[model samples]
Target: MKKFAMVSLAGVVTLGMVAGPATSLASTHEDPSTTDYSDVDTGHEEFNEGFNIYLALTNGDVILRQGDQRSEYVSDVQRLLDTRGFSTNVDGIFGPNTADSVRSYQDTYGLTVDGVVGPNTYQSLSDRHPYPNELFRYGDRGEYVMEIQRFLTEERGMEMAVDGIYGIETERNIRVYQEYSGLQVDGVVGPKTWDSIFTYVR
Candidate 1:
């Protein structure tokens, strides 16, 4: 009877070990590496699914969907979009506003209207929208405005913040840049000014 009891105890311990692992597995799940945000319908929901896609845009490895953070890459995208006539604030955030602008650009350029900045969309933007058509002067606000500020700060060796607003300091720098680049001395960023600036800096 003692040996029989010992055998039954061993069987119970074996069953407990098996059940412990199973119970643990049942209660645990693998953490998802990336949030799947493709099925988001509303603009509000789309903005809520923000992610970071700040990698280089080589071969479209870094996709800018609705929920991407406002990185320098997004700033570049906004510059391109503003150049192409889809006017959206170049605030770097990939919210519904940016998505709507991207879709407009895609539709106008005969690309797929998925509201995503992929390889094809990026290529189209790079190829077509080379520069902003409108004049970027004092009081102008956008990524391109910031780009001019960046060019002034980096290439021409100026000391200032690269804020997107075309404030008095930015205008002063633009005039300086224009004078240095042999362009018109006006503190405006039209096509000719942009051409000269791009030639000098980019």
Candidate 2:
């Protein structure tokens, strides 16, 4: 009888060990990593962080969409699309033409063909044609300088020629705007100045 009882106890212990691993495996299958977000909206907070980081790095904070008002953010997207040979007006307006261009860009780039410029679309655009991050000083010249000229003229009420030349007038305007905006007033379009300008524009 003692031998029989010992054998039954050993069998019970073996069964418990097998059951423990099975239970652990079942729990692991229900882990949060396996959770499905398919039913959730793509615009939810969970999915916007990456795109928000992209915008913050690029000095943009708005998610552009159709029928949105004219702003510098829209102009940035339009410029990016044009740079990629998508050919849309850089008019700072999210019109139908811009939407069609965005869709075409999305289709060509193997992104979702949604007309909205969401995080994924922005990532693809940035990957292909990154925004100019070079420092712009008094002697800089190009489209970025022209952008500054336009910003000073249209947003800050400064009368300057948008001729893509960062001459004395542009530097002076930058310093004045910097002083007025309570920035460092360095007269250089560095990250801080760019952020200040984009923050005000957006």
Highest TM-score against the true fold, candidate? 2
Badly placed stretches (over 4 Å) of model 1 are: 1-55, 128-202
Please state every model's RMSD to the true fold in angstroms: 27.6, 25.9
List runs of model 2 lying over 4 Å from the truth. 1-84, 89-97, 108-111, 119-136, 139-158, 180-182, 194-202
lDDT of 1 by residue, 1-202 (tens): 0010011253342111221221221123322222232332222221112112212453667788887884767877786688667988888889899999999998987999999999788766654124645577665555566666765454335655786666655666666556555777777888877865543322
Tens-place lDDT digits, model 2, residues 46-148: 2233334446535445578899764656776786688668888888889999999999998988988989887678756755212245577765555566766
> Clashing residue pairs in candidate 1, if any?
70-92
Largest lDDT belongs to which candidate? 2
Deviation from native of the Cα of residue 194 in model 1, angstroms = 12
